[model samples]
Target: MAPISAIALLSFSLLSISISLILSSNIIEDLNLPPPPDFRSTILKNCKENPLIRYCNAVSGDISDVFKSTIVAQHLCNESKNPNCSNSFTKIDLSTRPLIAPLYLSFTFFWKYCPLTILTIDLSNNSLKGSFPSDILFCSQIQSLDLSYNGLIGEIPTDGFTNLTNLTFLNLSYNQFGESNILRLHYFARFNSSSFLRSGLLAKDRKFNVGSIVLQVFLLIFVVGIIGCFGWRCLQRPDLLPFFLQRKHKFTQAVLKAATDGFSEGNLVGRNKRVEIYKGILRDGSEGLIEIHRGKFSFESRRDFVEECRILVQLDHKNLVQVLGWCDNREFRAVAMRWTDGYTVVEWLSRNPQWKHRLKVLMRVVEAMCYLQDQWPQVGCEIRTSSIFLSNDHEPLISKLKVQDKNNPSKNVYKFGVFLLELVSNRSPHEGFETGETGFVEWIKIHYRHHVRKVIDERMKTTVITFVQVKQAIGIGLMCTDVSNNQQPSLHQISKMIDRVYQSSLVSQSATHRHKIQRTPTNALKVNGD
Candidate 1:
């Protein structure tokens, strides 16, 4: 009797266990959960098959709340309907329960709806921290993504959304990833006008509509056609091609790396406050130089590049350094300029101490500045000593001179004259003696009133410069640098004054020679017989 009783108990226990297992499997299947195709099925199946994940159907008042509680549960509970409940989750009410870290639940759901037209995994307002999962790349059909307001860090990996080629709306803002890496994903959107996702959720005007789409398509077609036509035209009429077009250049990064020999220390050409210039050679054996402006990669940098290009193109002058073109690509941002084989005026003056050549160079620079001021009245420009360069043969030149008033209607000639003074005296406009705290112009006026020698270049001590010539130049420089803008002379007036100074110097020298001849001794005199 005892043996029979023990056998019955064993049979009952076995039957109960089998019934429980069958019910659990049925419940998991009935849940009809989705699965992420790319992630391992074992992981997905385990999460889905877990009794905790099935509690939503048993006791769910709200689906979102049930999922939230289950997500934070300690372990799978067979008896309790709310197995994953936690006190922390009770205080927080989330719009949607995004399976935060152990992402098996979300992964399964994604795979099950494998061909979903748009899979929006918006976990915003959740205050979730840590880097975004690498497995997100598996969502091949995800057309729109809103991962904003999360505490995602590190880089938005290039491979993060590599498979999400169909993506249109991508919002990863209000996060910690650096903006520099954003360009890596810029090409993901289609060329269609409607393809671009407008930034800022609140910006109603930013959204792209059907009209925008048509415009975008038209623009794309237009651009492609123009590029094709340009290439064809260049092939037909080679002479029409510019220097940059003639030489097929690589992308900015490749060119920079090759030119700098992998950015080696030896390749650094020059360093300024804003940029570092480097010498580079293109694939077609064409020599070039590039300036790497200091700024982090962002939308602002993109805008600056456009502005810089516009400025360079408009202010075209022979004396100024020519901007060949600019490059704004994903990995590199730089400006390509014509490489001038001339030393700076400072270097040239230091090497060649000849006063005559220095004077000639200074005059040439003055002439260039004066010409620019006269021609481009809209561009009130200035040429400093630093802007001047001297050729290998010690011929003076000027380059990289910028316009002071880019949008001014009337010309400012006074500023041009002040620049000439700096070039002539080898003194900065701010330096030298002032008459009444006005500046270099006032200083020049004081010197002219007193003595020319005080303001003249010391190198001209042995060389002759007439008082009249000095005074005229000083007067012109003062006129250019006058406090009142209208008091400045016109370019025509400036040209006349320069001519007068030259004539006066010649006349004064001629007079001095005649005086010397008059004072010659009678024994040394040679008589010219008629």
Candidate 2:
């Protein structure tokens, strides 16, 4: 009876335990509860351990805690209603959430909540401002990550990103990332280049040293300076310029022929054995005077012709005729100059005979002579009234050069003396002297000192004329034309003496005019009344 009682007690205890277990299982099934209640506890634990999860609660001021709790309740309810409900998140798409903070995640939180391994995390267009999130390195399993169109700055964490072996697609475009080492880009070779567009993460290969950059700049400046000096020199000597650069003053035979109307007789203004001058309309519809060399020449002569033409074309001065261009051909070579429509100095003097105008014309002529002498000391230019043209404003333009007179500066001075005599006497050098006299200079010399009044032009005998100034000018001419002597002054010195004479003449004229004004009857009456 005692053994039976002990066995029965043990069996009763075992049956009670089984009943409790069955009742608990039946209650759980009837209530439609979830598999477990540890989900909420696990999330709370993760929030404590994960900085990103805590950030949500801190940024939302505990509001995110209530929201997360509500989400938990809803998830629990859904799982209770549907046994197949999933608890793992493969992707977390928080794109275009402008109020969200910069993203960060922890491995423990990610593994606990998303055990299947996170495949994508899109946080683009969030206006999230900060450096690249360092905590993203914990989510190494993420295959497609997007953080584009944000305000993220600082260098990209390339070293930490290399640990993400599972990452396949990355879109960090439109962020403000800083430059990094070029070697770091190789770690992301598997991804497309567009993934880093506008992120400022593209490493530039800055191989140029400061020294090399400075050297390149210095070379550029040196080249520019050399070119500038060449240009300046070419302005004075156009023949020295490159052939292509000289094309402005080069012309073809066909163009010149068309301009001069095939060198017709009607177009011929003057002719000589060696040269023929034609007045022609250029292609640009402007009048041009063309001088064509008539006879054929040797190679050296042609070369000399070209060299002379180039030099003549580049002689730029207001008181000189501008040679526009030149044309060279197998048949002939031609020089072109702008056609000036004005009278010779002799004709102009006949129309305007005022002493002031005459003095002005003479001074400008002297200046032009000095300029030519400076340019070609060995070549003498014949200075005479016939070789000077007067513009509408009475400005003198020296037009002719006596190429036959070479290496003779005295000849230039003699010619200038003859020109001065002609200007003052208003008589042609060819006709003024007696038939028996030596030349124009001798005729002027004989009458200039003793019979100076006779040598002066009758037209300039008015009261406005100052005889003292006239005597000074005649003296200069006489000195210049003294052929028996070889002590002729240089052209530059002659210019200075002429300038001084002009200034003194101005003073004497003013003084004489003042005396005449003081002697006037109106002035005497005013003085008597006072």
Candidate 3:
């Protein structure tokens, strides 16, 4: 009876507890994101330095509390639902991934929350309107970072970023990064100019050639036979004169606009849903290609769009279409790439209807891809026929390289296999799937050994190609299309394999030609006389 009474009281307490609780309808409301007043006060108290205080004051009105400012910092920890200090500090794991640490998290708070276990800090693109942090370098455990896309006004830390060998991938784009100290990027190993990108650093240095500026303006006015060019400018206003002179400079809206001739429709050379390509002459009198953003893009905000273009303009590789500079004014936005003559890859392939010629062109494309991959380890985008362009000399050039989330090297290999199939079959990737017979990879697997020859384009069959060469190409393609990255051959390995076949074909053709000459009556008489 006593035990029953005790159990009944406990049950009653549990029932009371359950009845007292009331769940709110908006459990995921905005106010829930920020911490209570005590947490905010604690964060503010910890931010002792002048820079941190200035930043806090600027952002305080935006967030309900300090917790709102720490979204990116939360990702640094494994499960930081509430960033409260618990442990006395220790070293962090350097192998952990770097994140955007664009917050005004103070060193005091850093130790409190990080607690010796946090591997890295991230505060990128947080609109931290202030000077740089005073003492973040005290965190010995921090390996990598991202202080990019902030408005922190100052020279980069004199301490340098390469102090930690384990650190990789530091992006400082779109910030007021330029000061007298920042001469070149490689000086800071972890933060480079060309790779993930360092924009605005070199904008002041691009120094659009002055000599070419005068020549181009002269060419523009005289060649068009417009004597009123000076009068036209004078009538337009005094402001227009300075604009024309400085158009020869970079990182300005007027520069790109003048280059595109006010984005005229008559100069339009290419069109797409997202971008418009226009042919134009740069301030240097050299022809240029302009890619204008016409519609909504992958960017979430205008800032993101500007940041993306800023990064893109910094990349330079022989294989990559040369991105000279960009424009991001209030209304107009564009990216300028080096102009090249001739047709897209489709036209080149259609004109040169030979298997050997096509193979060589494909090899050049592969070489370009390999270079791109080597220069930027993170680059692993799809390689399609449409993305490739052919110069007048038949030089294959990759027109674009868009970095995306799915950066598995195997993805590129798979796309290459599809490209190979297109070249061999002379059919688009979706051409055969209309009847639902099978997908490209599945069809190839089904006809691997038997009736494989039937899939080859009838035009390609005219050439006396070796069975081994054809089989090698087909087998390589099949392997590339495999689901597993481990199973697929690397681009370097594929290049070697292709080169082997190409050399064999060259040797075989030469031998056959020599045999023909030896058999000829005129050659036989000349040889006998010798």
Residues 1-530, candidate 1: write the lDDT tens digits: 22222112112222323343324533334234322232233223333444223322323233332222222221211222322222111111221444432343244432322222224444454555666655555556666666666666655565656767777676665555533324424564343323222322212323334466789999999999999998776654443566666533224555556656776677688897777888876444566677777556788868766665656556556565566666666445777666768777766555535444544554555565565555654433445556566667656555554434363322345555665565556666555545322566666677767676677666544335554455567677777677565656666667667766666666666887998988998666866741
Best by lDDT: 2
- lDDT (C-alpha) at residue 230 in model 3: 66
- Per-candidate clashes come to 10, 0, 9
In candidate 2, position 201 carries an lDDT of: 68
Ranking by TM-score: 3, 2, 1
Give the lDDT of residue 132 in candidate 2.
Answer: 78
Poorest 10 consecutive residues by lDDT, candidate 3 = 5-14
Question: lDDT per model, in order?
Answer: 0.51, 0.65, 0.57
* Model 2 per-residue lDDT at 288: 90
Instruction: Give candidate 2's TM-score.
Output: 0.48
lDDT for model 3, please: 0.57
Model 3 misplaced regions, further than 4 Å: 1-251, 295-300, 435-438, 461-464, 484-486, 523-530
Better of 1 and 3 by TM-score: 3
Per-model TM-score, in order, reads: 0.43, 0.48, 0.49
Worst 10 residues of 2 by lDDT: 5-14
